[model samples]
Target: MSKIDVDSVGQTREGTFKYDWKMSALYNLGIGA
Candidate 1:
């Protein structure tokens, strides 16, 4: 089977999703933290 590009995950029109503090905070807030 072909390999998937892990770096492409969470890509969007705005930009690629990075695992930075901003994104982590957003995720936590999104989950009602």
Candidate 2:
């Protein structure tokens, strides 16, 4: 793939992982942990 394509894909993956982490952290907090 082109460099631009690779860069976008990497950025999207990083954003998705960060969002999932934040959601899980909020869930844990809601459960009193």
Candidate 3:
């Protein structure tokens, strides 16, 4: 249904955001070190 599709998209976006944030943090730490 449309609701399920919306939920899935939201979840995917949130997951990607979290992953990108973690990656950026790691990259910054490596640069600092």
lDDT per residue as tens, model 2, 1-33 = 255455456467777577668768888999999
Candidate 2 lDDT score relative to the true structure: 0.69
Please write out the lDDT profile of model 1 over residues 1-33, one tens digit for every residue. 012235446566344444445567888999999
- Alpha-carbon shift of residue 16 in model 2 (angstroms): 0.3
Question: Backbone clash tally for model 3?
Answer: 0
What TM-score number comes out for model 2?
A: 0.62
Between candidates 1 and 3, name the one with more favorable TM-score. 3
Candidate 3: list runs displaced more than 4 Å: 1-11
The ten-residue window of minimal lDDT in model 2 covers: 1-10
- How far in Å is the alpha carbon of 14 misplaced in model 2? 0.3
Cα lDDT of model 1 overall? Answer: 0.54
Q: What digit string (tens of lDDT, one per residue) describes model 3 on residues 1-33? A: 455455457577787577667768888998995
Model 3 misses residue 19 by how many Å? Answer: 0.3
